[model samples]
Target: MRLFLCEKPSQARDIAKALGVRGKGEGCLTGAGVTVTWCIGHLLETAPPDAYDPRYKQWRLEHLPIVPEQWRMQVKPKTASQFKAVKRLLGQASEVVIATDADREGEMIARELLDHCRYRGPIQRLWLSALDDASIQKALAALRPGASTFSLYHCALGRSRADWLIGMNLSRLFTLLGQRSGYQGVLPVGRVQTPTLRLVVDRDRSIEAFQPVAWWGIDVKLEAARQVFIAQWQAPKAACDEEGRCLQQPIAEAAKAKMASAPSAQVTDVRTERMKETAPLPFDLGTLQQLCSRKFGLGAQETLDIAQALYETYKAITYPRSDCGYLPMSQHAEAPAVLAGLKRADPALVPLFDHINPGRRSRAWNDAKVSAHHGIIPTTVAPNLDKLPPRHRQVYTLIRARYLAQFLLEHSYDRTRATFECAGETLLATGKQVIEPGWKRALPEALAAQPGREPAQPLPPLARRDQCPVRDVQLKNNWTQPPKPFTEGDLISAMKNVARLVEDPKLKQKLKETTGIGTEATRAGIIQGLLDRGYLTKAGKALAATPAGCSLVDAVPRAITDPGTTAIWEQALDMVQSGEMPLEEFLARQSAWMSKLVERCKGLNVTIEGQAKAPAWKKKRKPAGARRAPAGKGRKRTAPAE
Candidate 1:
């Protein structure tokens, strides 16, 4: 019998329905000599440090770098029963089909199990982008040989082992070091988590060290035919900062006084240009998470969870773990069906139906720009809007709006910039008049506001040399503000575009080529892990590093905490995925680097000054005059001589 293996039960059910597999078994469905079974994520996981040797369990400096000669994986106890069911089916089958998520991690999940179970059969891969019946049927006609994706497994394995080496060894090394300093807390670290934590820690440091600089500005109100508009005084180049902020208070004050005393102002120049704004590309997981965090106050992980439900549960949208916001050219052909489903999904979309052109093509459709998966979009299957929870409906609406935007015309406007001379001071005013709302009309005005923009006020028409009365002039004082603390949305955006933050020119370009610090699927989890470990805390919507997080970043080596290091690893992993670098070679280099790190940290003499106090649950007050207990006999040995 031919067997189908899937990543989750929901995925299996969708595939089974498409293939007409109606008979239900213990952990699978069966019909017409075909069997479908599923894994609850991964049936097998890499063995922990203690699995190699019991002595490794005791945290000691000597056993810092634990590298196994031969890596091993064992069945996860929680999902052992499902593993048995799959193994039995594998034993009886002559052919097996891999029907899991289309990504590196999914490849590893299936390939690792087949290797462990010793399944020696012809294997085929079903690369489905969506769990909808039509998508499944389409994918069924084009199954790739399992060998075609075998390299992805190696790529993923290399990443997993490298993360393990760093996390298991470095985490132990730092925890032991913290214990020696009279702080009894586990200092957990990882390849991605460490660098991610450092980002917040460094930002906090910058904010703390920031000294606000005072600046001044003057605004002049000019009136023409009963219409009033404000014009900002432009300081001379020699008296202004690089950003054109008037830093010389005397010049600003003089300009304010001169403008106030002036009887009239002459319009020096008025330039108007028509501009067009293309709609934003559709949602990739990172972009979607960032938008949800900003608009709905949802955390990164929370956004991913909601998007995942829309994909797997309701079949309302396509895959949510996509990295590219560009759609494949081939997918453009299905826009009519998806558009029809969207109209049926919500009545609020009735007005937009007249504007959407089924054949219209936007810049978003490009085969070359598409990555592992295309952008997250609506499926041809329409979901019942009334049945969806509020959060789900809100997120679905945002995703649908972006897709609808592709069929509409570009937003067009006329931008007008006016320059005036008043009392020997040069003043500037700008305004925009919309010629066509176009794609912007598909979204609410609040949602369509550009990032970091305030509402613009429309201006009255003006001539190049027309004169106007000077109504009012006011001097305003402002201070340069420090960088704001990250919200989950801000953090997601930073991770996605981390190249902007790197100081080194070469490394910055490399990060840009390789995308960013973490994969779209894993970044949310990394941020969540930091919060669960108390390395980060939430204050309203802003994210802050706890004292422990700051202390750990201070104690760790710069090389490990640098975002550049993670970017380098990502480049190497990409090479592995493309077969440019062998899997064994990558692991060997990682093992050597980890060994040297452990050795270097062992001899280092450092103290964690101002360590964060233990959490209240772990804090206890002893009787007065009672001495604190020593950590252990090994504490003195672990500490270096001052």
Candidate 2:
């Protein structure tokens, strides 16, 4: 009998349906010589330190760096029944198929089980991105040889082991160190979560240290041929700051007075240019999370959940964990069916039918840019919008709109910039007029362009050197605002674009090419981990680092907190995936790195100045008149410091 292994129960059901498997069995679906089984995420996780040696169970400074000579995997007690059922099935199978999620983590889920069960049989791979019946059927007809993606297991194993070395060694090291500093909270750290925590800590520090700067500006309302418009006074370079904000209050006041006294101004230049803006690419998980956070005030994880429901539960969309916003060129052949289904999914999209031409293609359809999974899009299966929950409907609508946008014309507009000279002051006014609504027609008002800033109004027609009467002049005072605190959405975007945070050009390019810190599938969980550990707290939509969180970043070594370390790891993992670097080499380097961190930080004396006192464990106090060695080494040392 042939057996198919899947990542989740929902996924197993979808694949079983495609294979005409209707009989339900004890932990799987079975029919006519085929049995489908699934894993609830990973049935096996990397064994904790204590699993190797009972002595390691107690957290001690001496047990600082626990690098395992031989890694072990244990079946999770919560899902042990499912593992047994899978093992029994593997024992009876003549051939096996790995039908898990189409990514590195997904590969680990199935391969780990295969290794544990000691199954040796001919294997095939089912690379699926959508849960709809048609998509499942298509994937079944084009199965790949298991060898094509065999290296992916090594890459995932390398990543899992690397995370283990960092998380186990570093977390214990820092937590133990914190205990010495009178901090009782456990400082849990991970390869991705640490750098993510540092991002928030650094942002919080910047905000705490920010000092607002006061500035001034002048606005004049002018009337030309019974048409009125507003223009702002342009500050000279010497009187302005680097960002072009006027810094001289006196100069701004003089300009306001001079402009108020002037009766008329002559327009020096009126340049009007037409521009075309291509439709935005379809939704990648990161961009979708960012938009949902901004528009609907949804958390990153919440957005991912809604998207997952749309993909798996309702079959209204394709895969949600995609990092690429570009679609495969071959998939473009199904656009007509998808469009027809989209129109039937929601009645609101009916009016957009005329605007959407199935033949027209946008830049989103690119073969080379497509990743493991294409962008999130509507499937050919029509969904009943009324059957979906309110949030599901909202997310599905957004996904549908992006798909509809690909078939519409480009958004076109004419931009006008008018410059005027009045009472020795230079003033400028700008306006935009849309020539074609085009793809924008498919989007709701909330998803419209420039949703945050005030929209530009239509400008009155004026010729070059035309005279206009000054109606009124107003002096406006402005303050240079500090950066806004990070929202959950903002943190998601920051994680994906961490290259911008690095100062080194080579590292920046590497991060950019590798698609930033965490994978699209894991960033949401990373942020949630920080929140769960009390390292971060959410205020309204903004994420703020707590004292424990900030202190953890301060206490941790620079190598662990810096994003560059993770970027380098990602590069190595990529090399492993491509078979350029061996998994053994990657694991060896990570183990060496972990040992060095423990050695360097084991002897240091560190303390967080303000916090409740922890349990006494060799507390030491300085003598009143003792001379300090240096400011850096002046801290009173405490025994049992990690």
RMSD values for the candidates in order, in angstroms, are 5.7, 6.9
- Candidates in order have lDDT scores of 0.83, 0.83
lDDT of 1: 0.83
Least accurate 10 contiguous residues by lDDT in model 2: 630-639
Name every residue pair that clashes in candidate 2: none
What digit string (tens of lDDT, one per residue) describes model 2 on residues 89-152? Answer: 9999999899999988888889989998899999999999899998998899999999998989
TM-score of each: 0.94, 0.94
Could you give candidate 1's per-residue lDDT for residues 1-642 as a string of tens digits? 989999999999999999999999988999999999998887887776677888865778887688888999888798899999998888988999999889988888888889999998899999988989989999999999999998889988888778778877777788778777776556666766778888898888999999998899888889986899888889999987788888889888888888899998899999999999998899999999888888889988889889999999999899999988999998998998999888877788888888889899999999999988999999998888889999998899899889999999999999989999998889999888999999998886669887798666677889988898998888999999999999998898888788887898888988887677877887887777677657889988899998888888887898888888887887798899889999898999999998998999986554554444333433465421121111111100110100
Full-model lDDT, candidate 2 = 0.83
Model 2 regions lying over 4 Å from their true place: 608-642
RMSD of 2: 6.9
Stretches of candidate 1 off by over 4 Å are 503-506, 606-642
